[model samples]
Target: MTRGHFDDGALLAARLLLAGLFLGGAVQKAVDPAPAMALLAMRGMPEFLVWPALAFNALAGTALVLGVWTRPVALALAGYAAFTSIFHFQPADPWQMTIFVKNWAIAGGLLALAVAGAGRLAWRGGR
Candidate 1:
């Protein structure tokens, strides 16, 4: 659709799905921080960085879900997804392939949100 004719309902649906997915992942990490930390450690990230990463994931996901500061959150999540793709998914194992595709797809959607704003169907602002 043209920018002016963008479907707000579709955008809202996409945003909600993305936001829920992000929030769920963040909650999973928060609920089991040790495993998340272990995964990060296995990826060679510093141990001290795990908590902050977890917090960012949670906060950014929440913001996206709530349609609060949507552009910034989408941009942050797009960066996070890019990092995940480059760092966590480069090995190209079967399992990693799925994650790589998923991350990139999410990144694409987030980038769209960043460009399009949250749309009129969002809970705040534009609506």
Candidate 2:
């Protein structure tokens, strides 16, 4: 494949994969917000915070998949990933540490996406 084609495919894959991760989280929260609410309560945040978080994940994930406002969406998601990593910041637990680091890694990919933009293959939501 040509370089442009390869890049386009890669970008599309990244968008899909990244969006899928967030969408999955959103689904989990929606299906049983009690767990999220419990977590929020433990953190002293309002239980209702889960609703907004779920909404954000759904919207941002859809935006990435649809390639709408690609750069800005990517940047926002990157920030979200980094910020959410704090929740997994349990260094004593190997699993939590792994997730925390992985969140940072995902944020890195999102930063790259923001720099790269959506390219010609993007749907762009009919701007």
lDDT of 2 at 116: 89
* Clashing residue pair totals per candidate (backbone < 3 A): 0, 0
Which pairs of residues have clashing backbones in candidate 1?
none
Best by TM-score: 2
Q: Candidate 2 — what's its lDDT?
A: 0.90
- TM-score per prediction, in order, is 0.82, 0.91
lDDT of each: 0.78, 0.90
Q: RMSD in angstroms, candidate 2? A: 2.2
Question: Which residue pairs show collisions in model 2?
Answer: none
lDDT of 1 at 99: 83
lDDT of 1 by residue, 1-127 (tens): 5534358777777778887877777787777768667667888787777678767877887776667888888998998888877545656487777888889888999999998887765667554
